[model samples]
Target: MNQQLLSQVMASCVNAPDWLMKKRQLAVLLQERFKSTPAAEKIMAAWLANPSLAQLEQSVGEQTNADQVKAAGLHTTGWVNLPLFTAANAYPELLQENLMEKAISWQDSQLNAMHLALLNGGRFIYIPDGTIVKEPIELTVDCSLPNYHNLVIVGAGAQAAIVEHQTATGRQPAYFGTELLLGDGARVDYYQSNRFSAVQNHQAVRAYQAQHSVLNMYLALFDEHDLTTDFYANLDGQGGAAEIKMVTIASGQQVQDVQTQILNHGPHTVGNIVQNGVAKDKAVLNFHAVGKTERGAYGANSQQQSRILTLSDECKGEADPVLLIEENDVNAGHAASIGKVDADDLYYLESRGLSEHDAQVLLTRGFLLPVLNQFPDQKLREKLVDELAQRLEEKHE
Candidate 1:
């Protein structure tokens, strides 16, 4: 990274939160740790180089129409949250209230640090304590850029649901990072879904929950070429709970790597992770999950399950689930499996008149349907199913 480019990016971050400034400073020291620019960073740089909105649309591919956003009662933003934070928008009151002091830390790794240092602008969404937001807040990354770092703070007793996405664009690979801070008694339902054309799509999430809080996360991948998510949750307060679910479908040499870790820091904390995926063609899907009970978390309960079903003889699927228990009073377990579709179930579906290929598609869809069903929005659910169906059909063809 050149000094001039770094200075220019920093100049754009005027009035950035103090913590973010410190993080940027720390990033310089760790530059030697990471040798190359992350793939998502490259895409962001491309979008940044061409700032015209029209050209951006062409390069990154267009997102949902404005009409669809309005019909769904959603809020839309063209760039990442950075621009929103840099400029005073209509929601100044909300922005001022929820803007965290510092978003990223030196602990987030070299790639995340590089993203933070290079991000020109950022977006913020703050849910005040005790307030309930029924409608999901939608963020569309239609225009590629380096605005990957986002901060979401849910105050004590607050409740909200957020659906974030990067529409399938063949042009640029994208990277996104989010820090979710849930105050005591807060609750949040978070969903991240992606479909990109032969480009790497990456997201890193770090979350913390206070006492009696609840955090539910959903990851959905449809026809992704290369997908990677590093998700970590910290249950730091007693009675806190965290649940993560993921569903993915890969075909034609697509590669996916998903890692999730849950740490119980307080007694009586509960955590669960579950993922289901389908691989066809020469596609490969790999899952890694960890459930940990700390020494002082006497009553912590943790579990993880990772399952991948394969439809093609050439496909590859692997699931690795790990459990770490440091306290005797805590309960923890993990289950992992990779296998072909059930022969009996395939036969049963085939007996009903479906062709062999059709049977595989039907059963594959059924295997991953459970995770999608957990979404609260029926519209989103239907849309995801439609996309999944399209991806499945591609395999059949």
Candidate 2:
């Protein structure tokens, strides 16, 4: 263990509670299992020297109450990864004995003193064929830095199904990056949601699916004061299917840039995307859907759709759908629309003895029901709905 690195990380997160400090220590310990390359060392050094911890904590305090985090609940199961760099080689030995492996990569560059970087941490998860998980697996990342880099990788085997959820919280402006890989004949359902109080930044999500695999993703973004987000999806497997959906509500001068890329690399593949955006106050929302069919992707089918509803006169919304086809036998289509609430729909509901507020709520609920109903966890779904309702109330007021 490098005491200097430990001391630096500890000092940078001085305000964090002892429990979180212990968690970081555990994470650092787990880092030892993988062979550290030069790039990994440099990234670790930058992570230790991260300068935005204080600002992130302050921002988190302003946007989210501590009680909410505590109430979110924490559950863990199955084979847990222990810290890698402990005096007891027991953990590392267990990993080696079990034939487990990990991967780490990082990229950093600066132009005219402006920083651009990408950091990725991934664990190779090998589930035996036909393995099934009843409880969802969780990966929580708390980035405390300005100009950040993050990535997560999940691997599954044939006939395997896993549910993974990721959450990011804190202040400090950051650029978040993510990539997911699924194997042949495997299936994965992923859920990710983000909330930012006052961070100015951008984020991207990318995934690659293998033969006969299925990937279903659900994403929700709320409250990113003056921030932008870019999301992407790619399907590379034959007889594979990809379903992507996102819901975003931006207020208070925030700007959302949402992009989706679904590429068909195999025959008989299917891809679809549905995105909804709502903006209030001076916020701006930009939605882009791009579907590409490669030359070899004969008999592939793809469709993309985007919808935006503006609630305030000062708010702005943009929707663009693009399709690229190189195979004559492939089927592809795109649709996009940007508009406000329909006055007739509101009037009809009001005529049924519903108040304006109730009518608006009904409209909003109708817009989000398609995605919300797909959530298997009722508790989590209700929590998300409550959060959305609170944000909507704040926007209307």
Give TM per candidate. Answer: 0.80, 0.67
lDDT by candidate, in order shown: 0.70, 0.57
Best by TM-score: 1
lDDT top scorer: 1
Off by over 4 Å in 1: 1-4, 14-22, 34-84, 87-106, 120-122, 168-170, 343-353
Report the C-alpha lDDT of model 1 over 1-397, residue by residue, as the tens digit.
4455456545654555554555565564565475554554555456446421211211112324434322232224221222344322334444444333223353345556555555534445666678787778776665345335567878899888878776534354555677788999999998877545536766777788999999998878774567777888999999999999888887887778778899998999999998898888888888989998989998899999899999878989988888888899988888888989888988998999999889988888789998789877788888888877887777432
Whole-model alpha-carbon lDDT for candidate 2? 0.57
Stretches of candidate 2 off by over 4 Å are 1-130, 141-143, 146-169, 347-359
